[model samples]
Target: MEFSHRDDHNNLSLTRFESMLKTNNVLFFDSNEFENIIQHYLENGKIALAKKAIKMGLQQHPSSTNLRLYKTEICILENDLEKAEEILDELYELEPSNEEIYIQKASILSKKDQHQQAINALMIALEFTEDQDDDADLFSLIGMEYLFLEKYADALSYFEKCLEIDMHDYSALYNIIFCFDYLNKNKEAINFLNNYLDENPYCEVAWHQLGLQFTSLKEWKKALAAFDFAIISDDTFVGAYLEKGKVLEKLKCYNEAIEFYEMTLTLDEPTSFALLRIGHCHEKMGNLDLAVDFYYKTVHEDPLLDKGWIAITKFYNRSKNYQKALYYINKAINIDCENVAYWKLYAVINHRLNFLEEAEVGYKKSLDYGNYELETWISRADILTNLGEYEASIINLMQAAEFYPENAEIEYRLAGLNFMVQQNEKGIFHLKNGVLINQEYQFIIKELFPSITELQAVKNIIAVTEKS
Candidate 1:
């Protein structure tokens, strides 16, 4: 049976149905009805209800273009591009001229892996004009879409087009600076910014860009002057104060940087990145205990920030507090176990704490997840050798040597392991190569080659290699 709901004033009986669903804990709308409900809910800014209704609709109309568009919107909101792209292909076919449909499709494409094609589509969309008047005007929209796709050169082209039409287009002007920064065209960016600032000296955004550009060029003193102008333009500009602190830090003005960061915290909730920077400055200034405290608070304030956790872990490791290092590294792993750096760090802390078995597992996990580091391989081999797994250690060391054959230290280490296992011929081969590569270690040659009583042969090999 098709359930038709209506109430007074010809309104769809949505309020009555929703009220009943809430009070009785009932699921009222099926796919078609739920989609209609979501369209009405979205118009009224009831986004959460709209989301729930769309989800319900998707269950029944999984392939419906209209329902799929709604579902795609939800996915975009949730930052799930994969699911959004799956739904978008069908949606685009149903509404080819729909600007929002094309824009959303391009966004999903950019997120999913075809950034260049997505940028081309957005630029093509600019050729077709629309009646809607928005701050992200058509050209500005195309420029931003290019920015999101990381086609900074194309983005600059579009933004410049917008500025040619309206020089006071602040959004396009701001985006132009961002594009310039990304392209490393700082000189042109500075010239454009200086002109903008001359016309509108109170533009905090332009001033901030100018300051950051100066900072990038390592003109710290000039960067400070620009940042000061930004703050003067708008005392409430949080980014100005934060950036000024970074410039001061670069100039080795730690106390001043701390004061600026502290001032930023007074304006708003302390940013975890800023807190970590402050902690680093304090650590550089020999206030280790205060640095630790700041780092701890940074992690507590924003547990999701990887840098905060990393800062705390490094602090503990530097202080030789093995337990704290283990604690922070484990916490980071719990949050993002798939990250190779986190797993590597976990392995290092485990190894430092003598958790040999766990460290080995962590190292293997790190390598499996694509962590390729010379140090990690060397350390893992050393651990395996210490655990009496000679074959595994030799295999790992050999693989490492393939990538870094010229590393004398690694060659020497592998030779020692081979000699320990009574592979005298192999040990002598690598040892001679190692000494040839780095004759500074010639003093240890006799001791390493005690079994090879024929020093004349070893000397002959070294002489031939050095001549070659």
Candidate 2:
């Protein structure tokens, strides 16, 4: 049946079945009609009616293989895997060549989380199926099973087979790209998409995926050309427009980027991501007023979008408006205190405003939330040192050294902290380590440890390490 007429056909079958139900009269229908009626009810989620149709179908066509398979399908739907397996076993012995018997077995095994077993069943189904479309579906199913096993290369191979059988399989195309991305095969993905587009020239999805692969390789002009083709193929492709805007931004065409972003707002619902990008473009072009306006709109449009909140906070922070910056960052933290970046910025803002205690608390919160950036570790150590907690400063820098082993800045700071507490031997050890790693960072002592800059032991270690 043609797709356009399938609903009409199903409706006619449904009407006849419903009429038979109302009149309490037995109606004569071929096994095909009975299967259609059962399938239509099942598709419409009328399970009780589907079961009624199934019972009627079996009574009328007792030996119909397809109708009996529908019974196995219903059992699978109800998650009665044991019964489904038993039915499959009977069908297997009676009609070993029936592909659907194995397909149904795959479904039952999939429901039990036995993905490898499901794959084995689908492989058997593939061997018995002669229809090209049926083969494509089996390959797609096998690809999904491999995905569940996290075997991207195996999934990619099967999904590739799906496209080879039917180039119009968009789901298979997308899965192919997903597998390629997971495997970091961007160059291969580019080559594959280029080959596909040669035969299927107007495939908008292929063009869009090609653009994404080019973007990953930082081939900005190629990415722009691919997105342009995608937009030409389908002007209403909102994702293509958004991605093109990002490429334009990377190329420093801020005005052009803004225009593409605005086009998405007209084409679909106004998205916070588009609004945020528009705000950033304006900020880059020095349109401060327009920038802040769009930033505010972004947050108002989607308060849950943490990026929008951060943009607003950064805008105020850059303008040297500490009070407003603090207010916005506090709101962001209130929304998602678990975000380490938000807490890190909150700490910096509080420190600038001389709220040392609150800065200390914010830095600690950031660290607790998994902020392991070099600056965060260094800044927290600085905050402790300024608060006269020399021992805490030393301990904090010690943890930082584990992540950045042999880092000169960390060693320099450690030396300063040790010397501050009169631990001369430990101080000399770190000082030599710092100087040996990078003598260029020697100015750090003048900036952060000015009092220890002239210590004889510190100078001796620096000189000895420099000579060595």
Assess each prediction's global lDDT (C-alpha) against the native: 0.77, 0.92
Q: What are the C-alpha RMSDs, in order, of all predicted structures? A: 7.1, 4.9
Candidate 1 Cα lDDT to native: 0.77
Against the true structure, what is each candidate's TM-score? 0.69, 0.78
What is the Å distance of residue 76 in model 1 from its true position?
Answer: 10
Candidate 1 Cα errors over 4 Å, as ranges: 1-136, 144-151, 163-174, 321-370, 419-437, 441-468
Best by TM-score: 2
Lowest-sum lDDT 10-residue window in model 1: 1-10
Which candidate number has the best lDDT? 2
Number of clashes in model 1? 0
> Model 1, 419: alpha-carbon shift in Å?
4.3
lDDT of 2 at 387: 91
> How well is each residue in 1-468 modelled by candidate 1, as lDDT tens digits?
122444332245466547755775655455556666777777777788878777666666776667777778778877888878766766667766656666677677666667667666665555554553432465676677677767799889878878767776778888898889888899999998998778788888888889989988998888899989999988989999999999888888999999999988899888987898899999999999899989988988898888888888888888899898898899898988887877888889899889887898788888889876888887888788769787787888888888788877667666666766878678778877777678665444445435443555556655765676
